[model samples]
Target: MPFRAQPLRLVPVLAALLCTAPAAAQMDHAPARCTAPAGLPAPMASWRNPLALKAGADRKAAARAILTPGRTVTLALLPTPKVAYPVRPAKPGDSVSHGGLASFTVKEAGTWRVALGSGAWVDVISDGQAATSIAHGHGPDCTGIRKMVDYDLKPGRYTLQIAANGEDSLTLLVTRLP
Candidate 1:
């Protein structure tokens, strides 16, 4: 008789494997713990769509909106070579393919809020570590979802890793919390 693989025994092994996967990374948001940074009328940065393409399919056009201070930038967030960083390799069951990069300098050493107009998954990467508190995926405007991440930041430069779940056009804005 040939030996057979037991289906029930595989359940536990599969469950354990999923535990180590990056699923949590997809929904990592901790806004409740966020406190407003100290400073009245903190600096505000705005970027409008510079490409004027009104679409997120063009990689070069989308990259133009990479978060510059006191300026309006525009760009689509698609998976293309023009993206700021190399497209991350996809894993099984992963659907996100669009991403963009932006950098900002914090002048105050307090809690700050990074808000995005459309609902896109955002990662506040600093010192090579991802932020644990991100408040996003809400609102009732275009696309019906907005992303906001409040973070405690010091005086330094930081990068914002943003990605889109679909081929949607939108704008991104960054500002200091009250």
Candidate 2:
């Protein structure tokens, strides 16, 4: 009789555990959502409306899409093999991923920030050499920006290479830091 009562008492506990199992599993797999703050900083405000552009398969083709400073552009990329990067990406992109190139002219020498919405590799090239990145970080919360890389650049014609991106498109912004 005591054994029968013990099993009955455990019935409610077993039911509770079984019922909560699915909810716990769902919580573990749920994607995190970023809540927007009251406002974005000035540097990130232009990212709200990105200009659409197509990336070039090579440096010459990349001349068609010009990257403007302080403006955000969403680039449609090509397969990694199609892009002929002037300077190979320091960190090569996935062979199965996408990449492309675009041109930007730096009018003044300063620290320039390249912001992206994905974890793609960025290479700023000029005179057959790649500019070294000075700093790396993430964008402001809720802005949808995944990474930022800074480079010290002089006034010249440069190529902005986007590589190893998992998606077919990417959002990018090149801005000079004050």
Candidate 3:
């Protein structure tokens, strides 16, 4: 028999399942429990996304944290062969296809908020984890989102590039701090 049987029968089952101690009635509740993702590193243990961003259809997913320097023997590598879909396999430090995502090597791993100059959608790829599940800023007069990353950085060179449609109208300014 199909599970989509009587709708009335299902009501009671759902009600019972949802009927946990009402928080108002309970008076006291502990804390909510959660599992962190495997890839996140230390610097980002406290990572949180203010805006809910979804991993792009072609991009990978990230935990709240990321990789760290010195502590990292290996890293989450991204295979950025083509900007198109059905991405081909890649290695660590692959460049973004559309030049939309900027490739940077952070020292540690954690959730980092990206600051964009304008309200446009900016792609960010860190240490090869899927580009962070964030769309570019889209508020009034928002150019692009830009900010520092959570990965503890080492003394190394990184790349920041924007996607181009063979035409250029905007520019991205990138700087690193000590």
Best by lDDT: 2
| Deviation of model 2 at 16, angstroms | 24
94-131 in candidate 3: lDDT tens per residue? 34422233334554344444433332333444444335
RMSD of each: 12.4, 5.6, 15.2
C-alpha lDDT values of all predictions: 0.51, 0.89, 0.33
Top model by TM-score, which number?
A: 2
Which stretches of model 2 miss by more than 4 angstroms? 1-33
Question: Candidate 1: RMSD over Cα atoms?
Answer: 12.4
Q: TM-scores across all candidates?
A: 0.49, 0.79, 0.25
Candidates sorted by TM-score, best first: 2, 1, 3
Error of 2 at 143 (Å): 0.7
Q: Residue 112 CA error for candidate 2 (Å)?
A: 0.4
Worst ten-residue run, lDDT, model 3? Answer: 68-77
**Model 3: residues >4 Å from true position, as ranges?**
1-101, 126-129, 134-161, 164-178
Give the winner by lDDT: 1 or 2. 2
lDDT of each residue in 16-97, candidate 1, tens digit only: 8899666675556433332443222223333323333232223344344345543434435555343443233232113445
